[model samples]
Each structure stands twice: as C-alpha cells, then as structure tokens.
Target chain A: MSSPVTTKPFETTGPGKQVLEITDLKVSFPGLFKTVQAVRSIDLNIGVGEIHGLVGESGSGKSITAMSCLGLLPDSAVVEGSVKVTGHEINGTPEKQLARLRGGGAAMIFQNPMKALNPFFSVGQQMFDVIRCHRDLSKNEIRAEAEKALQAVQLPDPHLALKKYPHQMSGGQLQRVVIAMALACRPRLLIADEPTTALDVTVQAQIITLLRALARDHDLAILFITHDLGVVASLCDRVSVMYAGEVVESGSVGDLFANPSHPYTRKLMSTVPKLGLGEQSLDFIPGQVPDMSSPPAGCAFNPRCDMATDACLQPANKVLVVSKDTDVSGKHWAACHHVTGKKPSSETALSETLEEHNA
Target chain B: MSHLDQPADLLVVNKLHKTFTTKNGVMTAIDNLSFDVKAGETVALVGESGCGKSTVATCLLGLQSSDSGEIVVEGRNLLADSKAQGKSLGRDLGIVFQNPYASLNPKMKIKAIIAEPLKTAFRLRGVELQQRIIELLAHVGLGEEHMDRYPHEFSGGQRQRIAIARALAMESKLLILDEPTAALDVSVQAQVLQLLKQLQSENGLSYLFISHDLATVEFLAQRVLVMYLGRIVEAGTVAQVFKSPRHPYTRTLLDSVPSIDPARRDELKTLGGEIPSPLNRPVGCHFAPRCPRASDRCHKDVPQEITEQGHRFSCHHPINAAEE
Candidate 1:
C-alpha cells in the first residue's frame, strides 16, 4: 500500500518566532473537601499566524488550559507557572493590565453564541460595547467599524443584522456575528473553544473555511480547541493532546497522524468514522477518563491502554520527545516511554517492565 | 407502480406529503417523498437538521397526522385501518429517540419501563411479564441484576441498551431509530451500534434509520436515501450512492465531511447560501437555488426522477467521474 501523503508541515515558524508561550503551567481549584487539579504542569508554544490544535476528550484540561491563557478562569482556580503573550507575562499581571492585553492582544469566542452574546441587547450594541472598550473611537466611527466587521464575516445585510437580536438569527449567522465581534478587537491571538460543535454540517464547513482564511490573511495566531480529530487534520497545523490534566502528546498534524506512537492517540485515531466505506465496526478504547481529583500516578491512560505495564502505574517524567528518521521535520514529540527509545516497539518492553515489578 | 413491483411484506411509503402552517406561514415538510424498507434490511434517511426526517418518523408512529400520504405496514394500509386495528398495529412499530436521558423516566425502575409495552400490547401479567422483561434485557446485553436499578444509575450506553430493550419488548418488526447515538461518545457509540447490528441479525429485523451523520448511516444502512428540502434527491445502495453520487446535492453533502486522512486537507467545496426557508421555497426545484450546475432550465422546470439499474436520482446535470 502507498504511504499516506504527509500534508503541510505542522510547525510554520513565521517572521516572528512565537506569539504565545506557556511554561510549566498548572491550574487547580481549591474545593471544600479536596483540590481538583484541572491542568498539570505543561508547556506550549504557538508561532505567529499559526493555528494550533488542542485535542482531547471532555474534562481533559484542554479548556482549562485555554481559559488559563485568557485569564478567564474562576477566582477559585489557583494557577502556577508563567503565561507569556509576546514575551509579556500574564500569570501574575494585574487585572487592569490583563484587561488591556485581552482587549487588544487576545480575544476569545465561545461555543454557544446564544449564551455568549447578551440577550437583552441588540447585536449591534454588543459589538459596539466591545469595540468602544478597546478603542476610543466616536459614535459614527464605531458604528462604521461594527458594520465593516459584520461584512467581513460575510453576513447578509450587515446593517439589518446589527438591528436584530441574537434569537432572530440562525445558529450559523449567530456564530458569524460572534466571530465578527472577536475580529473587531484586532487581537493577535484567538482562542476558539468548540466553536462549530453546535452547528449543522454545512454551516460547520462554512465556519471552518472562514477561520482558516482569517488565520492565513490576517496573520492571526489561533488556539483551536476541539474534540474532533478529523477537524484537526484538515484545519490545524500543530496538535497537542491532553489526557487527565496533562498533555500526553504534541507534534505536527502530518507527523502525528502518519505515526501515532502513543496508544491513546492510536485508539482515538481508530475511532474516527470514515465516509464512502462499507459497513464495519470501529475500534474503541475501553473505560472513561479518570476523575481528576485523584488521578492514577504514572499515566492517566493506563487503565484504558492495552499496552500498559507496571511501570505505567508509577510516577514518570512528564514528556519524552521521540523522532523518527523518516520524519525529517524532527518536531514530533511523545510522552510514552516505549516510543522514546527506552524500549523497542515489540511486546518485550511490557514483559521487561512486568519482570522489574515482580523483582 | 403496480402491486407486483412493490415489496408487499415490508413497510412502503408512497406519495407522502406533509405541510405545517407555522406563524411565519405554511411550510411543506415532506414533498412527494416515497421509499421502502425491505424485510431484514436497513434503510437510512439522510438529510440536514430541518429537512423533515423527524416529521416522517412522527407520522410513521401515528403521533402526528400527515397532510396526505399512504403508509403501508405489512400489506396493511395504516391510514385506512380502523381505530381498533390501529391499537393492535402499535406492536409493529417501535421508535427510539436521540436522547435516552429524557426518554426514560427517572422514577420508574428498569423492569417497569420494559414491561410498559408488553403489558399494554398483550395484557401480559405475573410470571409471563417478568419472563419477557428478562428475555428483553438478555437480548439487549443487560442482565437480571440491572432490572432493579433506575435509569439514572446506568451510563449512557447502558441506558440506550435499556431503551432498545423496551423497543424490542413487543418483538417489533420495524424499528425507527431517530439519531439514537448522536448524544453518545465515540467509544460508547461503537458498542451501541454493535449491539444494534447483532440484534438485527438475530431477530431478522428491519430498521428505518434517520440521521444527519453520514458516517454512522454508512455503517448501519444498506439502502441510502438522500433528502433535501422535504424531497428525496437520490436513492440507491450504500456502495452506489457513496461511491458514485449522481445528484449534485448528494455530492455536496458527502464532500462536507472531513475524513481521518491528513492528505485531503484542501479547500472544501461548499454549497452556496443557506437552506432556504420552507415557507419561501423556490418554485421549480428545491435544490436549484444551491446547486452549482444549475442552468436556466433547472430554474424553470422540475426534473423527474430518473431510474437507471436500480439506482434512482433527480438531477439535470450529474457530475461525471472526470469532473469529480
């Protein structure tokens, strides 16, 4: 069989090296009984004008990581480590400074447009509030900019949209309006969390196309968070997978899909249903994501992993970067011990690990 | 078509039309839709969100009255049948909706939920009723231990299994599965689908599967019906329609799905504009407004359904292999 063609290189370091960087970040909520560790120590980097994907199942700390970046997590969340946007720190920055950075440097669009946009106000009024908060433009200029933003999203009859309420528009139209508001701020980084999950298939295609174009033409750095790996294959350049509050794998989309070393990644890839194919059953990973309050020690995926060993139950290093000679990109990294050259890909490693446990 | 041409034993729908008078105006939900589900075969109704697939399900279950149509179940005309006969005919049809959480009652135990249909259909009671519920639980892969627990105690997959058991209580010949796995996770969805496939083979059941997800439909359905704006655009076997889609709308719908392969990450071929309001549908062909190959002729007159080698499609200009 022919080898699958490797698409675009995941890491596209543009003119500027990096736009957003996080080092050793961790987030936890201090509960009355026990602390809920939402995100473990993790590091990430997004280059200028690049679309980075954060892929994971629900409650996998993907959303919490993005929320930590935007400084939008609840006050009960206690965060550690450094979050830098353009080499400026946001971890311990004052609320006033963070607001300025968020209003100008970073913006976010949520999944539910109806909940994100206020119902009492008109669409135009919401857009105007955001633009006015970031800029000192007058009434007519603000209205003009709002109309331009709406038109940029290709909404039909921009002026009529501004006059209408959120309920009056369709789901696709409401999402376009949300994107229009985010772009109106002229932010360099956009964090969209499951933006198209609630839309129809045709409308989802339209939204994805729009986001891809915006990232290319506007030189915007995007952190596209979603649970669908198929979408990541088509849209994202680099992908990072999180499991149980830790990033278990990170690499370029091409290198990752062609050779997924981590068992969790492999199981996830196998579950994607294909089109134009005959009836067949799908391979599934057993069990569910562990409760984060008291996660297992070594690897969170051990319970569901078919290749788990005794070593997998104990504490280990956070991540181990693995590179194959065939992948000249040399950017592929996996956190699994077996794939990192500590042991071979055969069944021998598990027996060895098991022997060590017995000894 | 003559009586000899139609499949007599299976469920056959002919010239089904349904229109609703909404506050916006009157809207046609199903426009001259016709199809059939063969015995022991699965027929899928594929369409977008508001294309009237749910309306067809409601009309088939006799929950909602249709504007006009003929519904035939096991050679019996459902519309022309008497009220007393309709009550007995309920056992022939069983439906499972998308959300299992809302469908199952929180207060009712699993045994009572499964027995609800058995008791009403046959007035079965005492030891017979208990034995039937146990048999249904076993058929759906549940056990006797699960009979005492409530619906909230089970996981999503297990709850769906209970729902399936309830549907199969009356030994239903035809099951209407309306987006049954949409609310489930991928791994859970796989198990549920596997169970359904096994049940179909064991009981020789016929299924009318309705969903917007093409992937699941490909796995479950033997015959595929592509719907758009209340009309069947294409009808054929899964291999014929998916491998060589003749209708432009069918091609558009299939092209919209993002596959697992990373190689095919090029520009997506999207249809122009949104689905038009049902109240303000175009005059000639419903899809003429969005079709890429629409000529002046397409806008002026409706095209007839063309049948070629058991594959039927309605289109003025079908995309050839070279163009595709």
Candidate 2:
C-alpha cells in the first residue's frame, strides 16, 4: 500500500467534454484455479455532467468494469487497456498516485452503505478525513466542508448526522452520507455502483435525486451502475448494457429503452414489472448470463437471444455499429448480427409489446 | 380459478399487537393489526421495510408472542396454553424467509435439509425418507436425483425450491412467505411465483405473501393488506386495493414502482427522506409527513376505518387530484 501522492486535478476542459474514457479495457483476477476474465475489452466514455448508466443483471460484469476504472480492483487483478480520467491515464499508475487520484480525480459509492461506512467512526470524522486527505484545508474548514457536503445530499440536520455513527443512519441516510463523502472531494467523476439497492423504494428515490442534483450542480461526470432500468431511464443520459464481460449495447437512454436493438436487451425489457403502467414482469431476459470461464464462441447473448442467427453463432467480427433508425442517428450501437431495421422508440417498444399480447 | 368467497378463514389475526421493549422505549412493531387469509387464498402484506410486515409473519407462526389481542389459527390460540401443553405449534404453519441463501443450512445436503422439518411431524424409514425427499424435489421442479446435491450446488431459484420443499414437508396448512422471491431475478422470480401459485391451487394451501413488489403481489394475492408503522392502514381485495388504492402510502408505493411505460415522464414522487424515526413516532397518522395529501386534520386527528364492500382505508383523507 502506498501513502498520499499527487492529486489529478478535476477537468480544465469546458463542460460537455469527456471526463473518463475507456478503450479496449480488459480486467482479470489471478486468484483461484483459472484466470477469470471479469471485464472484457470494453469501451466506455462519459462526458462532463453526463450520467452514463451501466445496466445489466447480476454477473453482467458492470460492477467490475466500474470498479476497475477507479483502480479499486484487488492487487491480484490484472488490468489492461487505457483508463483515462480527464485525459490522465490511471490504470498502470503507481499505488500512491492511484490512491491520491481516487478522491480528487474519481470517487465511488458502492451498493451497500452499511458496509461502506466504518461502524466505529462518526459520519463527521469520516467526511473530515476524506476532506483532509484530498484537500489542503484547515480543521475548521474541513468540518464546514464536511457539513456542507452532508447538507448537499439532503441529510437533514447535517450537524447531528455528522455526530452519529453509520449504524445510527437509515439505509437512505447512510447512502446519502456516502454521497456526502464522495462529494466532499468534489471529484471530476463519481462512480455509484447500485447505490440504492439496500434502500426502500422511497428512500431510493431520494438518493437518486440527490445524486442527479449533485452531478448537475457540479457538472460532474457520473457512472451510475444499476440493474433497475427504471433508475437508468430516470437518471442516465447515455446507457451501456453489459453481458458476459462485454458491452452488448450502448445508446441514449431514450433510444435504448424505446427501441433496444439487441435481442437480449428486448428480452430484458419484457421481464421488468411496469406497475400498472405497461409490461407485467421484471424484464426477465431469457437464459442465464453465459459462464465467463468458457463463454460462447459466438455472441455471448446468442444463447438467450430470440433472433440469433448462424452468423451470431460464430465469433463476433468486431463491435457492430448499429445504425440509429430509419434516419440513422448513429447513436445506438448494438453488437449483434441481427437488427436490420428501425430501433423501437419508447412508444413503439411498448405498443409492439402490447400488440404481441393482443396477438 | 373462481372467487374464494369463503367467510370462514383458515387464519384470522384480530387486533394482534407486538411491542418490543428495547431499553430506549416501547417499539410497537405491530399495532392493532387485523386481517385474515381464507383457505387457498394468497393475501399479500405490502409496505416499506420497517412497517412490521415481518413481525406479523412472526406472530402468525407463534415464534414471537404478541403483546395484546388474539391470533386464531382455526380456533387455536397460537399464544395460549401451548406452553402448558409443552408442545410446539410447528405443524400448521410454514415460513419462507426473504433470503434463500441464509435460510438454508450450507452444511446440510438438499435431501436432509428438506427432510429436517418432516422428521418432527412424521416418522419415515430410510427408503421412505429418500422417496419423500425425491418426491418433494420433483414437486419443486428439481430433478429427483438432486436429493444428494448440497444447497450450494444449486442456483438461487433452486435453493428457494429446497426451502419450499422443506416447508411442504411439514404439511403446513398456511404458508407465511416473507418476501420469498425478493432476492431472485425477475425471470427467475416470475417462475418461482408462478410455482407458488400452482402449488397453492393443487394443495389448496393458504399463503400470507409479503413483499414490497406490488406487481408480484397484485399477481398472486387474492386479498391485500397495506401495513404502515405496524398498523393495517388499508385492507382490500387485490382488485380493490390495486385498482383503487385508498391509502396515501399505498398510492405512493404504487407510483414509485419503476414503470415499463416509456411515455410516462419520470416525475415519480421522490418520497423525500427516510420514514421518521419509528422510535419517537408522532402522535397522529404515521404517514402524515410523507403523504402528499396530508392536511392539518391529518396531523391532528387519528382517522378511523371506513369500509365499503370489504375494501377499507384507515385515513381521514386519501383522495388525490388525479383520482378526483
């Protein structure tokens, strides 16, 4: 483990510019009997103030991808390819530099807040420590900074919350505290990995709103990872759906949700419960995610795909660039041999589904 | 397939109260909660996490004694005289916990784990036990030969099958499933829920299904009980509760459900903050702070129940602009 080092300062670039860029990024764990390819050569880039959602089912390798970006993966894990935050290369950097970059350049809020925050430490102490670690500020200034961050995430009575332990806070509150800690540093990029999974529906909503506000206010690039497409639709600008370590599709939230090009994406949309609004189930994708150990020779989702042809059964040629629509926006790209026509719009995706039900 | 208009209930909970005396103060986990599940009916108990839905499940099983009121399970006082008889009220009830992972013992093989509850109620020889275990495994959609596989050898859905098999082994008349499918993925969750529904019909078993997922509940529950702060805030048939939610809490929960309808703009009521600390609970309605339609009257007066055709809402006001 390395001590403190140089902080990779936040963006000097103008707004709407790229904050983090990943190209052919592959990560693997060297533990166990065989090397496990956790994150395949995946490409992802989030522009400043853009909410990029990594959506997929469990073991879809979304978390591993996000974790790898911050250099949060274990020492046994071998990472390859370029990971850049504000155009500063991160992955192969020394431990001390990487540690310094974590808070100042990038910050992460994990799924479970109870486990994320230390049980013994007061919320205030945790926030102050984070502030002091990343910023050269006085004790009183750090305390004020901590309080403001807590208040930013809408933790009522920030002073009291600071004095309280992690256990004393509710799941929602604890998550907000995590957000507060993350924001205290005001990193250029914030990676939230299922930050609301442990919270109640209502509490989850509050946390999502806080995150969105924080991103908008600070013009911070956010990598929001979640299984719930609803959250993705609500919070994200661009969305990337991962399966078996590789990105199956990436598109604007509206485009992806409306007309998901990949067959697996379509199947996924069918299973999620839409309350009384639309579809009935949690969009249940057909077939389980393929085992990464001996993944499919062809497309990973070909096993689960309803429209998979012989071409898909062969190894993917390259990341297939799916044209946007009849009037190709070129925004929606799906890695599949299928998808010959228009990507379904939100209205079409649903009405077409309703038509299938009626048929 | 038809409406189970059975007036006589298999399980009736009448004003059942469970208040725990934590050193800080009396935490009323379940307050004046009353509802019933008829034979073969699935009654979903839906609420936020700390709304005492789990406590109601506990009281039903006689695991936790209620502080006040009676729990009548087929005219049997679940609380009374069982201690004097030195008998455990283990047979009539079955419970499926939220996590199939934690509920199952990792060390035990699937056969023995499923057979653990049966040994108490019925005596079986080696062949008979093996046969029964095989039967249960098959019944739960597992291979009959899966009896030797340990719980770890199976997926989450399969492990839940093992749990269900154990519950069935006891021959429980009423099943208290506490968020059984919550841990499962939607596709797997759908299959498990469908299995539960099929098992209920075939065995004529009653289920007290508890879940935060309203769609799942709406699909399964014959009747629905809306709990808030350990109280039955609203109770109705599934059609009644879902089609016309009378309580604000139920309405908010429904609204919060991530919709598949893409046209529906996402101004979902971000129910701000956590539920006020359950310890120093306010004097009036528990949902007063969160309720969108909460009035000054709501903050001052405790609302009484107004019933219409078996659908009840305990609120001074539950109307929204959209409904009106």
lDDT of 2 by residue, B42-107 (tens): 899998888898988877777777788877777776667665212335677788888788999999
C-alpha RMSD over true interface residues, model 2: 10.5
Instruction: Provide per-model DockQ scores.
Output: 0.42, 0.36
Q: Which stretches in model 2 have alpha-carbon errors above 4 Å?
A: A1-17, A30-33, A277-287, A317-328, A342-359, B1-8, B83-89, B109-111, B118-165, B168-171, B320-324
Residue B99, candidate 2: alpha-carbon lDDT: 73
Off by over 4 Å in 1: A1-17, A29-36, A75-78, A85-103, A316-329, A340-359, B1-9, B81-90, B99-171, B321-324
Q: What would the per-residue lDDT of candidate 2 be over residues A1-359, giving only the tens digit for each residue?
A: 01111112223255425788887899887757767787888988777777888987777788888888888788888999988887778888898988888989899999889999899999888888899999999999998999898888887898898899987878888888898899889899999998877677777767766767777778888999987777777677778888889888876676677677777677777666555542243444545566676778788887877777888877553232344331223556677767654444544553444233212
The 10-residue segment with the lowest total lDDT in model 1 chain B: B1-10
Rate residue B245 of model 1 by lDDT.
Answer: 91
